[model samples]
Each structure stands twice: as C-alpha cells, then as structure tokens.
Target chain A: METPIEGIQWNSLGFSQTKTDFMVTSRFSTKIGRWEDLQVVQYGPVDVEPASAALNYGFSVFEGVKAFRSEDGSVQLFRPDMNAARFKQSAERMNMAAMDNELFIDAMCKVIAANSRFVPPCGEGALYLRPLLFASNCQLAAETEEFTFVVFASPTGNYFTSVDRGLRVLVTETYNRSAIDGVGFVKASGNYPATMLPKKLAIEKGFDDVLYTDSNESRFVEEASASNLFFVRDGKLYTPDTSRKTIHEGITRASLIYLARNELGMEVVDSEPLTVDMLKSAEEVFLSGTAIVIARVKSLTFENDADQEYKYPSYEVGKQLKEMLMDIQNGKRKAPSSWLIVDVPSLPVQDQ
Target chain B: MVQEGLYLESPREDLDWSSLRFSYTKCPSLVISDIDISDGADGAQWSAPRAIPHDPLKLEPSAGALNYGQTIFEGIKAFRHDDGSIHMFRIDENAKRLQRSAERILIPQVPEEIFVRAVKMCCVWNSSYVPPYDSGGALYLRPLVVATEPYLGVRSSKVFRLVVYATPVGPFFSKPEGLAVRLVTGFHRSYPNGVGSTKMGGNYAPCMQSMAEARQSGYDLVLYLDAKGRGLVEESTAANFFALVDGVLRTPSTHRKTILDGITCDSICYIARHVLGMKVVDDEDLPVELVRTAEQAFFTGTAVIVSPVKRIGHEADSEMAVICKSLDLAQELKVILTDIQFGRREAPEGWLTQVTPSDLEPLT
Candidate 1:
C-alpha cells in the first residue's frame, strides 16, 4: 500500500525539512575499492567518522533537483540528467570519485516510486532532492580515497516568500563568495559559509540577501548569494558569461535562455558581467535556481561609498518566462524535445 | 572515582609501531556536549561529554557541516616523559582557538573547560599508546567541531558535534637534514578577508592539490605566497615559515591576515626573546627572496616541531643551506622545549599540564 498522504497542507508549506519515509544511500571504501551499501534506508543518521575529511576539511559537493506532479497522474523530474552531469564535474574538481549518470538516474527513479504518495498535487510544489558526496575517511591530511554518497528528498515551497511583491538586494562591495580560478564554479559546501558574513550584513540593512562581485576587482556583479541572476534590456535577455570566472552554471537559467532564443525568436545575450548600472536601467531583473525557480527583483542598494538605490520598471518579462517554464513543468504545454522525464510508476507495498 | 560512561579500553598491540604515519589510528576517542542545530531553536552550546568507541557517527545527508563545510578543528599532542608521565602542551590555547573557528563558521563553540577535558580524557584512556621518549613518537590528539543540523539551504547550521581523538605517530622529521619544500606559484591557499587564520576545514581542503603536486616531485609539501602577487612568501601548506634575517628572527605577522597563528610558532618566539636573548621581529614583509639571502630558515607547528629548512625550490631556482648541526638555533630551541615537555627540564610557569586520573572524571 502507498504511504497515506493525509494531514499535509501542501499549499501552506514552507521551505523546510519534512522527513520523508525513505532516503537512498551508497558508500565507497578505499580498502574494498568498490561502491557498496547501496539501498533505500530509513530517513535518519548514518555512521560518520568524527575526523572524516568532510568534517575537518572542506571536501564535499552536492546537487539539487525537483520532481513535479504533472497534469497526468504520473510524477516527473526536471533536468535530473543535468544535475547528474554537473555532480560528476564538481566531484572531479574536488578530487572525489564519480557516480555515472545511470546510477544517479536510477536512484532518483527509485525514490520517486517509493515515496510516490508524497509527491504533491499538480500546482502546489515539487519534491526537492538533494544529493551530497563527500570524503569519508577519518584523517587530518587531504589524501583521502574513501567517500560517501547519499540522496534525500524534502517538500518545499517558494524559496522567497514574495512571489508577487519581489525583493530588495544589497550589492556587497566588501566581501566575496569565492576567488576566480578557485572552486567558485563548483558548488562546494565551503563556498556557502564564506558568504554568511556578507549575507548577515545585508539582512541587517533590511535587504533580502547579497550580490557578490568578482574577488579581485570587486566591480562586476558575479552572482547572488544563493542563485544566478538574469536581466532584460532593449528586448534582449542577458546573463553573465561564466566562461572564465567562478559563476555557477544554473540549469533553469540555461533552459530559459534556450527557450527565448530557439522558440520565442528573441535575442538572448550571454555577454559581459551585468554591472550595477545595467541592472538598474534594465527592463526587468530576476533570479533563477532549482528552488527560486524565477523571481523578479524590485530594487538594489549599492553599499559602496554612498548607499544608492536603483529600481526597475516592472516584472512583465520575468512573469511571462516563469509561466512559460511552469507550463512545461506541469505538462500544460508540450515541452521541447528532451526537457521532461515522466515515466515513474507508483511504488507497491513493502514488508517493513 | 571512576566515571559512569568512561570506557577504559585496552591499547592495541599490533606490529610495526615504529612505522606509524600521522593518520587516524584504532584508539578510542572522547566525545562531548553535542548540540543540535535546529531551525528556530536556540541549541545548547554543549552537553555532558563522554568517552566512546572509535567508529563512524550516524549522520543525515543534509547536515549543514557535511553540505556546507561548516566545520573547524584543532591539533595538539601528548608527550610521554622520561619518568613515564604524560602531559599536553598548551591545550588551553587549542580550546580558545576552537572558539574562534566556531565563530567564523557560526557553529556552536565548544566550552574551553569541556574542550580541554575531552583532550585529557582521550590521552588518559590511551596512555599506553604514547611512544617512548627515546623512540621519539608522540600521541597526536585531534579535536574536531562539526555542524550536524539537517537542512538543505546554504546557511549556518544550528546543531553541532564535538569529538577529540588520539593516535600514535612517528616524528615529522627523523633525520638531521630537514624538509625539502617547493614553491607552488599556481595555486592560492587563502585570500584577504578570508577564513585563513581560523582553523576551519575550508582553509586546509583547498591546499590538498598543491600538496599532492609536491609529493609527486619528491618534496615534503608546497610553499604558498599571497594569491595576488604570487611572490611574497606566506607559509607552507601545513606549517608557518620563519627566516633568520640579520640577527633577528622573523615570521609573517597575523596582521597580514594571511598566516595562521600556530601555537608552536608563538611558543618558539617566546623562547627566542626570553631564553635565547635574541631580538625577534614578527612585523617584517616576508619576501620570497628572503629564503635565498637569509642566514637560516625553518618551519614550526604542533606536529613538526622546529623543522630546519634544508632546501627551497621553485620552478628553476633552488636554494640549499649547509647542514650546520652546531650553529642551528632552531635545534637549540627545540631541545629546550622538548626537555621541558619530557619532564627532564623545568618549563615556564604555564607551559604543560599533567593529565591526572581525576581530570578524566565527568562533570556532575
């Protein structure tokens, strides 16, 4: 029998941990030299060495994917293959072992089947899946060969509460998230704590969060604290070209850019870093992520010598793009060639 | 009185104790006052600590420490004296440093009393594993503070865990000729206004690539410079660097906000001023060229005590020094510190703390 999905207020849910019934875990030991202990276990703590490199050294990487209940009753995943591809690239940078796409996709499908009842209704929210890979050897030095890989799911709502009201952002000139030519491009865990100092300062100043600049010059706006940025100007959608620096290549941002240029027949520019003035004078400013989906920006508080305020006209373009993406995600419109995967069957009963 | 939860486990008697490396051993470590970092909950800083078996800790996949690198740690050692008594060197300093590291990452700070007591308990329980003073092995104690709150956001964790463990390891340098180091001009350890000073996990993890490069080319470790200039000598991958220019001893000042404040580095500077009667200057621009022109150079830390510099190599430039066994001041300082540590010589007022049986008792 399926898990009874009762007493759940899916519409009123916030971005929090709900402790679903199951989590998929796997491990790799240096002595054995192969992946072992792969199964769907209870959603609880597993054995970890207190001195593991993940605890003493910043030696871990993770990815985020979302599963949505489509217009049909079947549940589907949005760009899970992209997440797996990026996970492999990130692990290579951190000197960790890689899990091929087949295992990564198979694990996601199993979790969706096992927790098929927990998948929310078509319009409420999606199941957020987090996959974390780390160095699990207990040592002080950085030469760790053993590692652990795990995947867990949580029911989450809008990342920013104000979907309609938009948000205020602080442009931090003093602090940086990561140095270019460093691990900035990779979604390493250490990169998050490095931004808490600047984010705290932004919150204290009554702003939503911070916008980090390049580490050396501190002039060009690289990215937001947690998400990627996009701006619309002169009938063109533009984002920073992260070909060289340490900006995260967001999948949502990539999909929207593809739709705009290929289908909508609009010009999409992946050009230079979006300056503070470009964002101010743009038609619309927005943030994109697996969690933030697509949210419009209201104003920017440039915290340089003098705190100057820059405002955009409206969020018409942002609203349209969000609807376009959600239409395909909810299966209201026919998705492009290979965007959505909707073949997960409901799981059967098990002997607990 | 014996504590209720203290596990007085026997020591291991496996072969090849002489060939032990500085890594995790099978000895049981002590864990204390684990605080859970929860959402909207003001977690306690610490709880009653106890001795536990050395095994894997059960953790969720979304733990803040495992996901965001919200972890910090300290390293110290327990030395066995000539009379077979064991003590720790400046463990109080390690406790204070752990607090600074916790603040940097927003993890709960382990109380100094709890932190110091945990280290002592690990040493007391594993006393048999301490290498003999003549064999030159020391029982290395590792104190780790990690965040364990299960959340998916990129924020600081509210839950935390503290662990202290002991392992017996051979000395860093067993011969007279000291370590050979290469200057890594490509990679950078830390930048300005970064968490370089704090003993956080992020500071050490990024340097693994450079350390691997050094090992591939037959060098001990890599030497780093200011990431901007790639010229000014910062420090080695693990230890701090010092050069003897003129008659004064010089190390990179923490005011530069780049060098980590090694306790061993600080203690040796004290002996230089008060015991050796030499003028020490920590406030000097440490240029990479100083290694070539300076009279002598060395590295210092808790693991590698006063290691003399035998050679410094960059891409094409390599500087070698004469093996002056008699004129090396670093050796003299190491001997004085070791003598005091081994109970063969009287140390300064608050240098070492003897780990007694009563110190292992759990607090009521």
Candidate 2:
C-alpha cells in the first residue's frame, strides 16, 4: 500500500493503519450462543448507533496487547493471559459480558495465526492487538438486548515516543477524563469521546497531551486521557494505584512495576496520589501503555490554578527502564519465569 | 386466539401517548390543541398505524433518541383468557414503570389512562394475532418513546414520538432448565450515582459487549457488581435478582440508583411479604456474595416473570460456584407468578386488567 503521508519517516511511524492485516470475528445468538468463524477479514467501517450506548453513554471497553516475532521465525503473543484477564475486567466494568479466559486466548491466537506475517520481525514493529466489545441490540429504548465483540490487529512501529517531541501537557479544571463512579478504569468508548474536546484544545495550545485531575476536587493527578501516568523522584518510582476513582491501568504500567523493582533493583511504588507539585519535584517522568510502551514527559503546564509550569530533568525515555522492559519483551533479557510464556505455540511467520 | 370481550375506541392524543406506536395511532386524532411543535415546520400530519407504512421510520439523523438518548420503553404482554377474554397482566404496573422510566430519563410524563387505552386499542385491532391461552404464547408489547427533534443538542427533544409494536412470544427461556449466570468482576450494570436504575436506551448499549462476551464464554447471563469492584451485586442484563436466603426473601434495594426497581421485582416483594408471610429485605448495603450463599436465587422481568441462576463465576477474584437452591426457588416463584398471570390463581387487588372483545371492537 502507498504511504499514508509522503515525506515522513516510515520506520519511525507506528505501524500505520494501512498495514493492519486481519481481524477475528464471532456472532452471538439465543439459539447458538457465541459462535466463532475466525477469519482475517479486511478492516472496514462498522455500523454504529448514533445514540449508541458507547457513543452517548460511554458503554464500551477495550484492551491493547501485542504479538511479538520471536527469533526463530515464529510469532508469539506476550502474556496474552494477562490481556484476557484485563479484558474480562474491562468488559465487566462496562456492564458487558466477560469473555472466558480460554476463549479470549483462543481468539487472540486465531488473529495471530491469520496475520502471522504482520507480527514484525524481532526488534522491529510489534503487532498491536485491540479487542473491542460493544452493545448491538436494536431495541430503541435504553435497555439493550444484544452485544458484539471483535479482535482487530495492527502492525505498528511504536507510539508517541517515536515522535521525539517534548510533551507540553496542560492540567485543566474545565475537563476531567472521568468523574467518581464513572467507567474510567475500563477502556469505555464513551470515555474517549468525552476527552476529545479537552484534548483538541490542549493540542491546539501546543501540548502533546492533557493530564487530568480528580473530577471532584481537581486535586491529585489521575491520568492522561489515553495513557496512565508514572513519575520518578529521588530514585523512587511512583505511579497511581488502581484503587483511586478513575484511570485505565495499562498493561505496560503494570509490567514496569515489576521491571523497575526486580530487574533494575529500584524501589518501585505503584500507587501514590500525585499532584502538580509532585511533577515539579519529580526527577524523571514518563507515561506507559500498549501503544506507547513508555514515553517521557518533559513539562507539565497547569491551565488551572494560575497556569504554572514545571519541567522534568530528562526529556529522553529512561534508558534503564526502557531497555530493561524492551529487553524482556524482545527475549534479549531473561524474564522472571512467571512473566514469560515461552512454551506457547508460535504461529508460522516471517523471519524474526 | 380470538378474544370476545376486549374493547377499543378512537385514539385520543389529548392524553399522553404512551409509546411510539400509540403516538402514531393517535396522530390523526391528535387534538390540534395538543400539538406542541415549536421548530416551525408545516406541523406535519399524524396517521394511524394502519395508514402508516411499516418501513423503517423517517427520522432526522440527529434526532433526540439518536443524540441525547431521549427515549424510554416498556415491555408488556397481552394474555388470552380461558373464556376468550383478553387481558394484560399488571398493565397498571407497566404504566407506573413507564412513568418512572420517563421521569428518570427526563422524558415527558405519560398518563396512565392514555397508556392503558392505547395498549387496549392495539390489542383489539390485532385481536387475531393473540395466540391461544393453552398455546403458552402471548403477544409481546413494546411501547417506545423517542425524541423526534431535528436539532442537535444535549437537552430533551421538543418533538417526541411514542410507539408500540406487538409480537407473539412463546417463552423468554425455552430451555427446560434454569440459566447459568456469571458474577461479573468490578462491573455494575448501573451505578449508585449513575443512571443504572432507569430503563434508558443508553444503559443497555453499554452492556452489549459484556453480554456477547459472556455468551461467548459459555455462560447464559451475567450478574454485574457495583462500581467499587467489591461483591455488591447489581442486576443482570435486563432482569432483577432475588434470593431466598434461609427463609427470608432478599433483593437489592434501589436508592437514587443501583438497580432498576423492576415492577415484577416489586410485585414479588409484595407477594412474598404480604401473602407468603416471608420476611423481605431491600437493603442495598448487602454485598452480592452474601446473596450467592443464599438458599435460592432467581431473576424477575416482564417476559420471564422469574428465572433462577445455576452458576456464578467471579473471574477476577477466582470465585465460581453453582447454586442448586437458586434453581429450585426460581421454579417455585415461576409457578406462583405464572398461575396468577394465566388466571388459574387469584391475583392481588387491582392487578390484572380484563378486556372484552366488544370493548376493543371498532365502533361503526
């Protein structure tokens, strides 16, 4: 396929949508229940209700995990079990049905098997996997009687950090990613729609992202609209715990918790109620997610409370943690036995 | 299938049109004084159900129901009496439920008398479609209220449409056995601070993914927990839950929100407390796990009056169990409720709304 935009560094850009290979699908009926006819159908437009629960009320949940191209010309998904577990959690959060872990794993395997070639060779672009579930009943009333789940794959280079642009995030009082009791922790579709306006305004203000504060008091840092936030100060790692009201606990964020502690011999504290002052005092800062595994934050712009600004010491992705995470993910460094799933069958694919 | 005692009259729009179909049926007769259009059109003509085409509705893309989710609906069934009389089971309750749904969803109030009249008129007009009482099939009534306004805004629609469609349904659960439900992890169907208790269109859309996943996972249904991820049990996809713990009947209580205070659920609570002499509990404070340990668990709705849960799966907390007692309790309630609905047993005062064919027959 032709490049989406000319004159751009192709390798630096994450696997563009033009390169997305295949998707796995299934149907549900009262008679047959859940039936899977796994195929690598080309990705295309889906009919969405304008007042769909997801569109109007944020009633969808999603998970992002990746398939890796191993050194032996075989494709393997990294801790798909974790993704399935998290997917179930997300599904439940959105009041959707939960996918049995075994079925979820099987579906992911089917996608990887169908698009084996797209699982980029080792050290290249990782295959991004997105599992989406949403309401599908035709009942015009608020009560839904049906639903749909799909797993789509995209071959991408990397996320956010590849741009090498410093992030100028504005902390705004006007917008909050999620209010208390909202579907913030889950990857609900409505959550993203709510963030679009504030995010657009922040981008127009020359910021890469916006850091959302608590919807109630606008006090502590919650998360970026898309990714979870992480900070390091005085050689100690600090990240928001999942217990707080709203935030998507990204898989990469959890992985880093282990990487920072065991692998790097650093004391990693995953849950700390952070504020703008916390960012100002931070020695290092970064964000984590499946798309952008880890991206460093250079500065924080507080639009609320007097528009104050704070900059971190380092603008580059932390070499120690990044290398450590990448090493384990790419099979360069040995992962704790519990973290690796080496025995799983790898689908036949291109050279790794 | 013919009911000899049901009655019908000319549609009157002066009263609140209960749903989309009812609103359509009364459009032509919508006393022009009742016309409340402000958007400045020709103030379009209204037509009866027979005169209107049965194709997909002609509505603006950005209409209220499509944008702000300004819609409410009720599910009811018309039963054929043994004496060839047609009756609606707990229609007044259905009206009250619709009213509550409207109030919660911020839609205009629908009067009880108009709602009953519209349903009776439709039943009379389609009397031939009512299945035989012994056939175990009844006509399912779906009364929907949607916003018809063309403007794109977050507020309620100025132009509202109410409609009712009838379908013959045999049984919601054809399976001889009970359903298996998995207790969801950290997901509440509705939240205490959110729109969980309302039967709004937006509420159901979000749950489609979860229901699809559950059915995919070899489960029949899902029982979502509250927002805190604790074991605070909410309702299933479309039904309310009740438990027979020890000898006391228990159900989740609704405050501002949490679970839809289902009409059937309320009826069951009434029967159990007043008639069966059973202790009833509606404390929304009880954790869901406590109910799971109850002697029996059952679900209630308009279609499947009461059904039982056989299994509960807690994927996150590594908990999964099957409660045989719940199945037994569900069967017990099903028999009682079915007997009352089918007219084999006596119902509480002001419950069943009897209809005569002559009452619904069009006057020459």
Candidate 3:
C-alpha cells in the first residue's frame, strides 16, 4: 500500500479546500473542433484573457463528485458517470463545448488517481472532485470560440460541520432560486451566485438556509439554496418534480430515492409537487446533495404566516438512510457493483 | 502641454477603418485596480490604479468569477470629433450602473471616481485607436470587475479586480436594411425578481443559445417578453426595445427590475422628449402587440446604438409584421445622438468627457 500524505489532519477536515498535488486539464478550440488530450499539471493559478467569455459573460459549468478511501485502503468513485452526463448537459445549456462522457470520466479518474494521497481514510472525509468547463477565449460579445476543462480535487469532511441535532430552515417567498425555463436544471456557475445573497439573509435571520418557492406562483416549494429537499408524510416520501425543469435533479437525491424504495422498502412519491402546506405537515424533512450527503430538517419557519414554525419529531428515517448510503459508499455492504468504480491506479507524487 | 510619448504607437495604418466590424481590435494598454478584504473589516483597501500592457490575467483556478459568476461589466464608447479630439459619451452613468451591478452580486463596488479615472486613462492610452470621425467607428471601452478569491464556498470573494480595456468597433448592425427580430416566447431571458437588471456576466450567457437559435432561423435578433406570461414587452438579447407608437416613444418600464437600464435608451429618451419635442412613454408597460401597430421600432445599447427593427415575427402566433420600411425616426435619432457624441451638435451638460493627453500625464 502507498503511504498517505504526512501533513494533512484528516480528522479535523472541514468543507474548505486543502491544496493537493496535481490536477487534470484539457483545452478545446473552434479550429481544433475536439478536446485535446488530458494533461496532469501542478495545481496552481491559471492564465486567462481578461475579456474571456468565462469571466465576462459567465460561460462556465461545473460538476461535483467525491472519491472515497474505503475500509481496506482502496480508493473508489461513486457514480461518476452520472456526474459526467450532467456535466455535458450543463455545458450544452451554457453554450460551451462539452467533452464526451468517456473523456469526462477518464479525466475524473486520472485526477483522483493522481491525488490519491489526499483521499481521507474511511469514516473521516472524502476527496471532493470539481470538474469545471468554461469559455477561455477573449470576446466582447456573448460567445466564445475556445474552451477549457479542468478537474481539481480538495479533501473535505462535511458540508454542515456542527449540525448534529438538525438544521433550522426558513421558507422564503420573497426570493426565487430560478425561473421556470431557466438554467436551474443545469449546474451552470451563474445559478449559484444569485443564491448567495438570499442565503446570507436567511443566515442573518437565524436559519441554516433558505427554502425557495417557485418564481411564478410562490405557492409551491422548490428547493433549498444548494440541495434538493424531501418531505416525509405518513411514511411516504414526497419531493419536488424535477421534470418541471426548475429544480436541479441531484444525483444524491436520486440514489437516496432508489435506496428508500429498493433497500428500505419505503413508499416513495418521487414526482409530486410538495407544497408549503405539505412541508409544514411533513413528519420528517431532509436534504440531499453531493456535499451534504443527507441532513435532517428539525424545523421550518415560514415567512408568510406570521413566522409560523413547524417542528418534526423524528430523524430515524434520515439516520437510517444516511447509514445505508454511507455503507454502500464505504464498501461495507453488498450492492450493485456498477455503483462503485474501484481499482483506481495511483501515480507517484512529482516534485513541485 | 502634457507628454506626447506617453501614448502607444498610432492606430494600425494597414487596416481599412470603414470595413471594420463590431469586433475586438486589440489596443496597446489597459488599466487595472484591485481591492482586497481578506485581512479584516477595517483592513479593506483598494490598490492604486495602474496601466499595464495588454496581456492575459493571472487568476487562481478556483476564482469566484470562474466558478460562481461573480462578475459585472460596463460598455462605453469614445468618438473622435471632426477636429481629431476624442470624447467619451455619458461615462458617469455607466460607472453608476456598474456599481449597482456590483452591489447586487455582493462584489466590492469600484468607486465612481476610480471607475471614471481608469476608463479615461485606458482611453487616453489607446487614443490612437479611436477611429477617424468620418469612418463611422469608435473606441469601445469595456470596464470589467471580477472576484478573484480562491475560496470554494458560495460567498462573496475577499479579493476583487477591475480591468478596463479598449477596442475599436464599427456599427454593431452593419445591415443598412435593418434588423429582423423574432419575438421569443419559448425561453425567458429574465424573471420578475431575478438578476436581469444587472449587467452581470450571468445574465448574458444563458441568453446566447436563444439568440443563436434565432439567428439560425433567418433573424438578426431575438426580442424577449416578460417571463411572467403577462404579454408585456421586455427587451432584446442585449439591448432595450422601443417603439414609436402614436408619435410617442414607448419602452418597457424598468420599475420591475427585469430589464437593464440602458444608457443609450436613456439618451434616446432624452432626445425624444426634450430635443426632438416628441412625447416619450418610458414608464409604461409596452405590450408585445403594440409592435404590430407601431410606426417604427428599434433597439438601443452601447453596441447597437440605435438599429431600426425592420420586422418582428412571432412563431407561436404565426404572425410576421413589418414595423417600418423607411426607418425615418430611427435614422434621425441615430444621427442626432452621433452628432452630439462627435461634438457636431451641442450636448447636454455632463454628456461628454473629452480625452486629452493631460489625462495620461500622471502615468508618464
């Protein structure tokens, strides 16, 4: 077995980034018409034109995936193919060139393998991979002829570091996360910045995050700032309809739904529109995302009804689900073999 | 007199200015300013503005501008008068608009003084690129601000950089026949409480696919409606829409904060109301149906200036209506605006800031 890096305090890792050794990158241009071969380079600053479309017009898309160090010290990726497919969709929505799924998966595997030392030990943390595609050429107009794709890694523990009891959420009717026909369904870089202000306001009002309502009617619940939401009523799971095209179809949310129905034998209502009233009456509510694997919602405060608060008494379902999912992720239990990509080849550390 | 050698070499002599299109023709230098807030609250400071050679910018791979769209920009033009002096048109408005955009996305606002000074310095350093007055070209100035911090979280950056560059551009729409616009109802450019009003990078890229698809269908531009299905006119891809209805200039109100506050649209409205003695209805809700019966229609922005719309087609309704054939009003307004910009006509107070060699004396 290869020795892990010496300096990292993996036990105290938070969601913030810890610098790693190497990253993978590729470039595409109109003249080339295809992505160049992936190159492993030192993880550091990159040079881009000041007038590039990525900086000037927000022509960028990104994906998030995590590679885990299992119980036996073997590194494996969880559902990277899903992330690659979504990355292509996001790039297409942003009008930038998208690398094929095969190249996308290959680049992710190479970066994870190169930074294998940074992957935390089992039960501590995971090496988070961020794959970004952006327009790299300088243009005054809202278009670009050249593009760049980079896959970088950071070791992180958990999204919510201190939320052991559960999260307190605020249901906001004033702000909308995305429009009906907007880029909410895609992982465009622009969609996230707009939520920063709303999230800050929610935090100021003493809440963990804001639960956004639809922009058109403001009567239905959409999603939290960064993750997908699920409501458990009468032991049946209800979530927002991603087919509405205004909600991001989170990969973690999909896996949890699959686990709830197939593994736990629970009744799952995946496609129904969970309204504010339904959320208020839910017995248990939770959020799912790549960063926040699964977080229980203890209470929700609605801004519309004189600051009415709804409290949930149980976190049993969420706890069980998190355990089962993590068990699958850590290679503790038997499941579909295709869910985990094991046997990632590690490259020797190069001198910086 | 100021130093004459402070400027770069004169504009390229081999190129035909008349044949230039609305594209980037690199200038000699650009001005930059940076702000850092990483130390503490009181430790926030903006670096002294500096002019550097035109080159690519170095940034951390995880910059907020690249990962989360913390970027905003403004566009202004410098026109050369008959006497060979260059003057920028209404730069103060662009500066204020940029500040508003910055505040929306939580970026540290570039001080109005710094923005104006940097743009003037950038233009003065590249004054030779200000095309000849008779060539119908202008030095287009782009002022951009981006968040440069390397944090992985979705929050405002502790570091921000502002870069101002210049490029010579001809008319945005070279077609003398006028632009053919398609009324797009399928995709909404912006929503009721969204960031459409800001000149942020986020608002533009998402609309490009819609604009490109429109172009492929034999149209020059796409005119978007309100996202709420109110049948109200919003704006074009990157410009504000206007119609000459019943001898009054009508445009969508910006009160909803769903459309950009266009500088050229304001200038045109001022001309229509005060200079040309025409009633301007800028605060009213312009319905999409109004274009079908309007006398003339046009789009206004820093790029387009005032390009007349020849026809508007609605695919859902199966209607193709010609707004105007002669474009008399659009032509007249464009001429008046251009004359004021080039120092031929009397400009309103604070309408133009003439670029002189003295503006670059401090740098020298």
* Candidates' chain A TM-scores: 0.94, 0.87, 0.95
- Give one digit per residue, the lDDT tens place, for model 3 in B26-60: 88788899998788536675666678899988877
After best superposition, candidate 3 residue B303: deviation in angstroms? Answer: 0.1
For candidate 1, give the lDDT. Answer: 0.76
Would you estimate the TM-scores of all the predictions?
0.91, 0.53, 0.96
List, for all models, the DockQ compared with the true complex.
0.57, 0.05, 0.73
lDDT per residue for candidate 3 within A218-308, as digits (tens), equals 8889899889998788988877988767899899998889888888899998887667888877999988888878888989998888456
Off by over 4 Å in 3: A159-161, A337-342, A347-352, B1-10, B40-43, B320-322, B360-364
Instruction: Please report how far candidate 2 places residue A24 from its true position, in Å.
Output: 26
- Mind giving the per-residue lDDT tens digits that candidate 2 earns over A173-259? 666655455556765544443454566677778888878877656777888867888888888888877775478877788888887
Shift in Å, residue A240, candidate 3 = 0.7
TM-score of chain B of each: 0.91, 0.83, 0.95
Instruction: Specify the highest-DockQ model's number.
Output: 3
- Predicted candidate 2 versus true structure: per-residue lDDT over B291-322, tens digit per residue: 75777777898766787776666455545474
Worst 10-residue lDDT window for candidate 3 chain A reads: A335-344
* Evaluation by TM-score, superior candidate among 1 and 2: 1
Model 2, residue A294: what's the lDDT?
Answer: 78
To one decimal place, how large is model 1's interface RMSD in Å?
A: 1.7
**Runs of candidate 2 exceeding 4 Å displacement:** A1-352, B1-53, B315-322, B356-364
Clashes of each: 9, 29, 0
The reply for model 1, stretches above 4 Å from the true place, is A1-4, A158-161, A233-235, A243-245, A264-271, A274-283, A338-342, A345-352, B1-16, B36-43, B173-176, B246-248, B292-295, B316-330, B360-364
